[model samples]
Target: MTTMTAPAQRFREFRMPDVGEGLTEAEILKWYVAVGDTVTDGQVICEVETAKAAVELPIPYDGVVSEIRFGEGTTVDVGTPIIVVDAGGDGAAGSADSGGSAGSAGVAASEPPAVQTPAPEAPPAEPKRQAVLVGYGVAPSATTRRPRKQAAPDVPAPDVPTADVPTAAVPAQAAELNGHDRAAAVDRPLAKPPVRKLAKELGIDLATVVPTGPNGVVTREDIRAAAAPPAALPPVTAAPEPLAATAGARETRIPIKGVRKATAQAMVTSAFTAPHVTEFVTFDITRTMKLVQELKEDRAFTGVRVGPLLLVAKALLVALKRHPEANAAWDEAAQEIVHKSYVNLGIAAATPRGLIVPNIKDAHDKTLPELAAALGELVATARDGKTSPAAMQGGTVTITNVGVFGVDTGTPILNPGESAILAFGAIKLQPWVHKGKVKPRQVTTLALSFDHRLVDGELGSRVLADVAAILEQPKRLLTWG
Candidate 1:
């Protein structure tokens, strides 16, 4: 008798990659493919947001998706298998074409494969490796959890006469009084890490807040609702009010995570660690303003943005070149001052996500046109939320343009690891004495904040003076630069 045998199926698994520098976990922002859908190599299959930035992950092999291990919005640890693909399997037509006897044989053959699939739970005989995307790789080690603290032994309840309650059910009754089941009262609450963080921030006890999520999980909305104060009841003589009108109308709680959370932590670190010394200079930038208008019409600057911030950036670069010590970092561990020869000028751009500073590498080497082009591209990329983590690293100096918000000068904080940050204020037509006469001139204030450890008062003043002088003359850029 001739026998029909089915081809063996080969499955490939894709793991969550470390997209950022040593980031342990990422929240799956989206998935582009589903089970039974065909995908090709190097096709973007998902986007994940790490603490540093949002990154898209691409599949490295071609196959039909067999399973997605995690759903969207779920935070997964790196090196965890996220998806499975069927790479070498017979088409569905092969199963259909098999007769009754062949089908029985195929079922018998599938049993052994199903039994072996659990082998993944144990170590494989041979480590299987596959190609991954550029700039990121799957970590080899698995995530290890810390051992839980041992709970205190339950103390025997004092003797109390209870006719109705059985002694065996007393502990369960006490748990119910505390707004939890007997098991839940003894174990940790069922909530995600993010939800737990929110609860801690709002000072709401997870055990007290009633869960309103799938599988009896605690959610952010539940935490917020618990924190919200009970509404005062209306008097019986007054007209009744709608329930929806007063709910959640007083305040809103935004869960701090992602870019905003990172920015807050960085600012706090910079503020406490660095001994900041800020110096202010109010000067007539009329000449620089005139140069801006001229550059806008210049053919060399066509298709590039020409603005005051661009000139301010160029001025800062020239100042850094003159005072190279200002472009440096303080190595606390080594107890030394590290000076930088090249300037990576950081422009602080505020987006919907939060404030981000992406720098122009080697800004001192670029000409006016090139610097303007780089500035335009940096601003555009940050606005679109596509700035990579690498672009924001290794900045020597920074500039924050508070003038864009129509505010005058204010002291700016130094970015962590950088020596100085310059804040540009609003340029308004103010009455100023120019050429020994009072006249309405385009004027602005400049605040230079520097690390006192690396830059003393004399050095910081000189750097600020040079930037102010360049903006005042607008021709010193050629002489000094």
Candidate 2:
């Protein structure tokens, strides 16, 4: 008698990658493909936003999509499987015959199929090296699974029963009180890992909360609701309103994650850690403004954006050349000051995601036209939300043009790990003393905030003075530069 064998199933899982360096989690922005869709190698499957930037992830292999483990807007930990693909193969069919002869084949078909038994256990041993993208490669041994809690063993009932309770009905009574079976009460709650973490943080017992999700699962909203106080209670001493209130609310709460959350944390750290000393200078910038107009019409600046900000950036670079000590970072851990030879000039851009500071690497080496091109590209990329994380790292100094918003002058905070930040104010035709006369001339304010620990008052003053002097007389850019 001949026994027929089924085709073996081959599935490959793709985990959420650490797109940025050492990022632990990322939120799934959107999914480009769904289940039952055929996918090829290096096809973009989804977009995810980390703390740094939003990056698109591509599938590394060719297969038919079998499952999407996480939906959009779900933040997943690194190395956790997010999708599964069916890589068609029949290798297990051959392994089925290796174990048995024709005589035992009849017994195998009648009993639980022995070949397919180990299929569930085979995934742990499979190498994970092939499950990586081109640039972001996860280590083979980096995949970690949270340990599951074991169910408590059953205990014997007491011989004597109380008047209120009976030994036979103990399990049912416990199940009714907890809204679940006695066995399930001992097991872990039916919630996702993130929800469980939130419940733990909010000090809410998952068992006590009612499950409103499908299949009796507890959701994030359920945890929030459980943590909120009951509305029936009297308002004793005007308590603050809840963050997650009922519908038709007076306030809207945006979840703090991704770029906004990261920026908040970094700003807080910078504010308390750095000793900021801001110095301001209001001067007649008519010469520099005229130079901007001249550069716009210049053939050398063809196809490039020539503006006041470009000259301001160039002036700052020139100032750094004179005062190199200002372009340094305080290394707290090492207890030393790192004086950088090259300047990675950071330009603060406000994108839809949040405020990001992507710097031009080796800005001191670039010429005037090249600096303008870089600034234009940086602003355009930031507006389109395509700035990379690497472009934001290693900034020696920063410039924030608050002038674009038509704001006069405000002391700006230094970017984290940098020594100084310059705020360029709005350039307007104000009455100013130019050439020994009070005349309506183009005037602007410049505020320079520096870390006092590394840059003393003398050095900060000199750097600010140099930038103002260059803008006041554009000829100094050729002379001093």
Candidate 3:
């Protein structure tokens, strides 16, 4: 009797998705799984640092991992297959389970229940795949790198008269290679593309440099060391002296790829694209400060964050409602102003990665305590670098509390698509006239920067004035909101 063999398991590849936004590439920061590990659908497989932020990528299918196409620290382009999994759809495992049940039924009459049956003829198949949710299935494309160009063939030089040849030339070549072609051919060391370019610019030959990198690859330091003074070279005559060890800077260059790169590009685009006009106002926030303290004692704010920032955010939303034009975005391609009805209030939080402006969704709809809770969660998530891309998108307005750093205030740049940004300055006790009497009051400065194309000076001034009024009065929020 012939036993049937099971069909082969099918593998599915997972390609890198854009995460969010149209970011083209990301560097694999860490891998959470290895070959042969069982992974479920929606499990985080790896963390990648993109031009925007560090994001954790979730595998969309359930199966045993088969391969990791790229190692950690490798930058992979969007749509590239980074992992493979065995998603067995064919009834390989089911067939083995049927055979095992049959074998168990035949042996139960004579043997003990604990006795083991004979193993199946084939290996267990991988788990079946589930529906992917985060990103699409693996893209069909080749994963090979482009081939390097071939060096041109060397041409044999025409014979020269031995009588006229210099003796020094012939001896130098023999000495350099020890009269062996193999020694000459093995002189060139391996290096990454960037290191090779650096070596070329510094006039250092890789052939002479020693390798210090993994697998005998030459590094930037190796090139610099090869170019350094030989310890025996005599001092040079009065031209610009070579940069000595003391003069040479020991610099550490961090790649500008992730958050820093994204922030820089966004700031540059916003600064140049929008004609920014900043208006500052110094006001007494003593009433706002007193309200924050009173709210902290109230049961409504129990275990919830109550602070000046929470009040500032609420005031901004109220001001936006008053001056709707200031809370709009410019659609350059459509040549129209997009006025948003809802507020996605963004609060700028400084993180290890960089500045990320994550917003509270529908913040205008939330009560003061609810807004405080949302703000607290947003700040905590941002600090932990757990803020999702969706949370950072579609901000109608932003508040950057520069006061935390003791900064007076700054001409804050608008977020790429948003029309306005409010910079809240440090609050300090200063002598001020209140009801015609000079008394010490809590004073702070507010700088509002807005796009002139969407919000005119009058509209911007109204929004700023409204926010200042609410802070100074503390009771205007009830009337305005």
Please list the C-alpha lDDT of all candidates, in the order they appear. Answer: 0.77, 0.79, 0.77
The segments of candidate 3 whose C-alpha lies over 4 angstroms from its true place after superposition are 1-9, 87-91, 95-250
Candidate 2 whole-model C-alpha lDDT, 0 to 1: 0.79
Q: Can you give the TM-score per candidate against the true fold?
A: 0.70, 0.73, 0.69
Clashing pairs in 3: none
Better of 1 and 3 by TM-score: 1
Model 1 scores worst on lDDT over the 10 consecutive residues at 143-152
Determine the C-alpha RMSD for candidate 2 after optimal superposition of all C-alphas.
9.0
Better-scoring candidate (lDDT), 1 or 2: 2
lDDT of 1 by residue, 37-110 (tens): 99887888998876667778888767899889899988786665788778765433455466665664566566
Candidate 2: TM-score? 0.73
User: Which residue pairs collide, candidate 1?
Assistant: none
Q: Estimate, for each residue in 1-481, the C-alpha lDDT of model 3 and write its tens digit.
A: 3244433335777888877666667889999999999999889999988776678888877789988889998887666578988877434456546756455444443554323232323323333333333455343322222111111124221222222222222322322333356244334466655578889999988888867764466876688677768762332211232333336645433556677788999999999999999999999999999999999999999998889999999999889888776778899899999988899999999999898899999998999889999999999888888788889998988999999999999999999999899999999999999999999999999999999999899999999999999999989998878
